[model samples]
Target: MHFCELGDPGELSPSQILIRTEFSGITNGTERHAMLGEFNWNHFPGRHGYQHVGIIEATGNEVEGFNTGERVFYGAYVGHRAWHIVDTENGPPLLITLPDGMDHPYCALFGVAGVGLRCVRRVRVRPAQKVWVVGQGLIGGFAAQAARAYGAHVTVTDIDENRLSLARSCGTHRVLDACDERVFEQLKEGGPYNIVIDGSGYKDLFFDIQEHALLARRGVIGALAVRGETTFDWSMLHQRELSVEVSCHFAVEDLTILRHFVREHIIHIKPVVSHRVSIDEAPDIYTILRDRPAELLGVIF
Candidate 1:
């Protein structure tokens, strides 16, 4: 994608506010997929981000409950730049007031936290039950923590040892090497898991989970990562009568719930963030991510 300076959108309308971005979180899932032409709705030079924390620089006369210099957490499809115009009258709610003493960088992770919350909820995990997460990227890692918070025994797997290590530090009960062919056999020793989550965004791995992992009778399979087509044994699926559930983006209420998770310290924000860069370095960083996926996790811009 081409990057260059552009004139800022001048002056806010009556219900608008001008935001000076302090930090924006890079999403390895949607943004990476979009940049690679895998996301159908995004085109080349397409706007790229949905996670940012900023200060309200200017507010129109009609705007209420927001003041200049107020720190706010906002999300939109186009928030990677230094400045953004938020018209409250248009589109989904874009601004959320940052709680006192909340770290801006951590606020940028709210979206990811929400994804984890949603995915775990979809799986309908129960207390004391085993939950297997097949991927240890940011989302997967967070999903494992969320499951643990829900009182489930969480195990995470990934090909990247670094990511798996991060998951271990985040309190996952077990971390497995996804590349190992015996991974599923090992996982089954804990008994068939109540839920098996696919957060690796790897279609082949998802297929492998379907083929090898033994889920609890009528267990749930939650797809928390990006979706793609892959073939697996339909007969196996039929015989097991497994339930597959797919998750989408977070909703407004999900954000509210995530805020509570943060307050209660159920979601660990610090370990998930792995890199930091100025907005100007974003282009190069994206290139690195494209070439080497394991080199980074949560990146702040």
Candidate 2:
């Protein structure tokens, strides 16, 4: 990844605000896909970040409910930078004044957490339901916590022990090492999951779920991970009458609910944070992300 100067943002408009960024979270999966040009929408030499936390340095005269010096989370689509000029009336509809005592670093992860929340809500997770989350990366970990907050019995699996430990810390009912030889047996013990979420970005897991009969009849499958393509047996799906649900970017309401959960300590973000570096260190971090992704999580700039 390369950084280039885009010059000044120019003068702020009547409905705009100037922000000095404090922290920005990496949307690991999506950004990696973009970097590799895996997605059809990806273009060369493009900016790619959505999670941003910054202080409002200046606000337009017409701006209401937001003022200078307030730390807020802004989902800037223009990508990560040192400064941002947000048009309140016509900008991305993801600007919010963070609650008092919210950690700026953790707040930077709201974008990814909100995606997890949206996935859980879209699958209609309910109290006492059994939910299995594949993978314990940032999105998977957050999804497990969100499911638990909704009163579901959440089981999370991952090849990374550290991530599994993080999931356990976040209140997942069960954490399994996906590499274990008895993994399938262990999953069967918690079998017939009401909802299964794919946060691993591994298409093969979908077929594994079917082969092992891990999901209950009519159970919902949430494809929350980014992937190039997915292939599954049509006959198996028809026989079980299962439903497949998919969610992309989160909505504002998802962020609102996620903030409440984080404030209540029901959803944990700090535990998954593995790095906090300055903007200058971004290139090194991205190299690790490309070469050794398992070494990183919850990175903030």
Candidate 3:
């Protein structure tokens, strides 16, 4: 934390974009995972950094679809304040032209929502298929809702009863306490599940259930939780024919579809939001995210 009376606008070159940030949303999963000293982006494309809506102060020589004073979205995990300069490489795969009816906060949730969309898309959910979502913070909540949009009968599981309440309100069939004794009984009778999405940031379930895992036939697992260390038994997934995947950030092409969804209101990604703050307040807010994370889906500034 440095004390400064003022700061300078950042700099960038071609295929680059410079934005005066108006607002950004905190990705609780990734941000919290990063804070726990358990972050693991070691060999991947690294992390999402951060993305939010801002005014275009400058555009790189090679950039297009953006102009001075234009509002657009871009991401960088560490983030930039006052003014941020990012090469088009860091910008959205494509620029977003905010419609007149939308709010910047809703725009900020786009990146996160895109990931959820991708997860649901991959599920290829069959109409009336039973789906289980294992968390409901931001990612899990979005996944649960998206599954519903895909016409699946969805259920959400979370340790927090309050978050469970939100999931129920968000259209889940039922909430399960994975930490309780009654959890197994709640498993739909006659079978385990056609699909199971694990948004929890832990691998303990995989380890513990490997013994009696035959319960879920043709099961699938999605690890969207942003925790540090998670374990999996590859052979189990192979034996059970469970399709396992991880949900990441949105791809460049997905923006148009998401924009359309947001525009048409066919999908709802707004409920997870629980806080709003400013850039100057981000550092302190980061601590609040680490110590007490529950129902606090987004921190916008």
Candidate 4:
């Protein structure tokens, strides 16, 4: 059952506004975790839990900075179908309207891209800083490219050979097998990096990397993980003075930065589509995503 449909959309009270989703892009990080119920229940029952890149089709008189037919990137819950009426008393602030040249599918992938871009922003990579990115899916690719645009030397690591090859073709300097038994040794050989970006959706992986991260000493460790409850060891970070930053959402400024980067060809924003399925096929695709999910970015409806 789609958790988003657990509520009524037609009942926006006198104080609420409504939004319509032209197309909702599923984020690999948060979507995967939520599908498994691996999230803090404290944040539930809010207007948003998933990241939806949608547009406002209608609104209450109280709503400002929005109008019908203006394409925008907004967030909402799981039931962001073709048309949705929401009570937008508290929603993510509208990021921006789609530029003239950018298309809808590209807009669909923007949420995932923004998450990665925010990761780079959090670590504060300087020009020419050496960076290492783990995971070579859409977010990983975007993070690696974003760091490079920030003037960092980037090396991308992933277990999938095809993804690694794609990252290499996309100008990644070094590619390492993250699944190898000597993965830490391989990373150490290239270590003393200024930053390490983790785009893997699993929180368990983050816990495992504590020793090898070297994050405390001379590098920044950034994550786009969908974490629930976990333990953090701050004492270990005291020695290396590493900065640990977790990025959740993209601010409006981040959207502007992404837009400028995409327009300037610095971000290389592209739809990482594996298949195109119709809205009618969404149920099957959801099952696919729920069962044998691969390194897929999304199935656009």
Displacement of the residue 290 alpha carbon in candidate 4, Å: 1.4
Ranking by lDDT: 2, 1, 3, 4
Per-residue alpha-carbon lDDT of candidate 4 for residues 134-169, written as tens digits (9 for 90 to 100): 888877888887888788888878888887877776
Question: Could you tell which candidate, 2 or 4, scores higher by lDDT?
Answer: 2
lDDT of 2 at 124: 96
Best by TM-score: 2
TM-score of 4: 0.79
Poorly placed runs, candidate 2 (over 4 Å): 90-92
The better candidate by lDDT, 1 or 4, is: 1
lDDT of 1 by residue, 229-286 (tens): 7566776567778778889777767777677777787778877787887877887888
Better of 2 and 4 by TM-score: 2
* TM-scores of the models, in the order given: 0.89, 0.95, 0.81, 0.79
Which residue pairs in candidate 1 collide?
none
**Tens digits of lDDT, candidate 2, 79-167:** 89888888868644578888778776889989989889999999999999999999988888888899999999999999988888878
Superior candidate under TM-score, 1 versus 3: 1
lDDT of 3 by residue, 1-301 (tens): 2323336754566778777778777777766665565654433322334667878888877887778788876654544355566666654554576766766676777777777767776766677887777777777877787787778888777888878887877767777776787676665442366777767765576764465452276677766666555667788777777777776766666666677777766566566677776667866776677776764676677
Clashes of 4: 4
Global fold similarity of model 2 (TM-score): 0.95
Which residues of candidate 1, in runs, are more than 4 Å off?
61-68, 90-92, 204-213, 235-237
